[model samples]
Target: MIKKPVKIQLSEGLDARPIALLVQEASQYSSSVYIEVDQKQVNAKSIMGMMSLTLLPGEEITVVANGTDEKEAAAGIERFLVNVKNR
Candidate 1:
């Protein structure tokens, strides 16, 4: 398992579209991926779960992944959150 804290750099925050895209990004990995904030954790691949987070720009979140592709999953999520323009 790997856990890494990342700051959201998205200018528009995690609105519906971004959340959907994020869910899609997470779904590509074989690892189990989750996003944690304020002691709340949700499956990164679930659009409803991610929407419940209500994450905003500048809010720090923890990306957790546990599986054969854990490292790649975590790094991909971190990159997605940090580099908004590419997403």
Candidate 2:
């Protein structure tokens, strides 16, 4: 398992589109990926699960992945969360 902290840089936090995009990005990995915040963790591949968090811009989150591809998965998610621009 690998855990890395990432701060959401989206100006408006993660809305429907962003969540969908994130979910899509996460689904590509074989690893089990999750985002943790405020003691709550949600499956990274589920849109509904991510929505439940109500994460806000600048909120720090932990990206956790456990599986054969854990490191790649975590790094990919961290890059997406921190560097991707809103479209």
Candidate 3:
């Protein structure tokens, strides 16, 4: 599996509630999503998993996408992490 590591800086991001919401929406992707957090394989597709990661601004995260829709999954997450701001 080819994994892409992206370093993102965090903003207020429309309050903390939105982060949970963002993870919820991202988890809907068909492809698998896992976060390389705390040197652990945390499932990004799960709200609990994402929340457990404690992702914040200026934090580097490695998102691993496997399966046929790998590109799509990676792109979706990439966009999310990049465009995240306090909106």
Task: Write candidate 1's Cα lDDT for 1-87 as tens digits.
Answer: 999999999777888887888898899999999999998999999999999988887889999999999999999898888875575
lDDT of 3 by residue, 1-87 (tens): 658887765664223465576576566677777778657887776666666666666777788888778888888777777776633
Candidate with the larger TM-score of 2 and 3: 2
Model 2 lDDT tens row, 27-59: 999999999998899999999999888878899
Best by lDDT: 2
Error (Å) of candidate 1 at residue 14 is 0.5
For model 1 the local lDDT of residue 86 reads 76
lDDT measured at residue 87 in model 3 versus the true structure, 0 to 100: 31
**Which portions of model 2 miss their true places by more than 4 Å?**
none
| lDDT of candidate model 1 versus the reference | 0.90
What are the lDDT scores of the predictions, listed in order?
A: 0.90, 0.91, 0.69
Q: Give the CA lDDT, 0 to 100, for residue 51 in model 3.
A: 63
